[model samples]
Target: MNYKQIVQYGVLIFGAIILIGLVLKGNISHEKFDSEKWKNWTETESELSLRWDMMNSLRNNHELIGKTRTEIIELLGKPDSETKMDFRYYLGMSKHGINTGSLTIKFNENRIVTDFSVWQG
Candidate 1:
């Protein structure tokens, strides 16, 4: 073969090798991302805001009675400890700082909330 033809073939082979190396280094594939699913996470921000508002309201007013168990969970997040005494179930919230108080809730036989109260610590 002529020198020119040999150089042309060498350049083509080198270009093919470089292209294959890049392809092997990174296996590019199509990925589908649903916009609706991405937008769904925004709802969590609203949920967190609602929880914060409820917590503020509960902190301002420490009254626990008349509020259902669901509302208590929403306001207090979760109890620190739960213990079952002979007749009633006790749910407790630990004392934080000087401004914060501990919360105690009592449940009846059917796991329904009968009474709840907050105490200063």
Candidate 2:
């Protein structure tokens, strides 16, 4: 790459790293990951540190068997995006310096959470 192109790429990467840091602050847990914790924190996210803090909140604060979408939103703030039966939250994933992935929450007709999954791209 030319000098200017390299500088531009460097700047973009640095900005991405900073943005990820902001988005992840206090979002994940310091403890080890466990299914019970709703955290699959691993290499996909670069092992930097992210805990699915919102998901953890749902598992801990609400009754997953019956919690409504509105109730969940109240705790996690607005979702990054949503669709007919799915809501998405982005935690800024980065593996080997490339960021991708998001958390997807699926709901039943009653708007109650059936389960959630991670989308690693």
Clashes found in each candidate (C-alpha, N, C closer than 3 A): 0, 1
Local distance difference test, per candidate? Answer: 0.45, 0.63
Looking at model 2, report the run of 10 residues with the lowest lDDT sum: 32-41
Runs of candidate 2 with Cα error greater than 4 angstroms are 1-65
Candidate 1, residue 36: CA error in Å? 23
- Among these predicted structures, which one has the highest lDDT? 2
Runs of candidate 1 exceeding 4 Å displacement: 1-56, 59-71, 85-100
Give residue 25's lDDT in candidate 1 (0 to 100): 49
For candidate 1, the TM-score is 0.32
| Model 1 / residue 30 / CA error / Å | 52
lDDT for model 1 comes to 0.45
What would the TM-score be for candidate 2 when compared with the true structure? 0.48
- What is the Cα-based lDDT of residue 65 in candidate 1? 55
| Residue 17 shift from truth in candidate 2, angstroms | 31
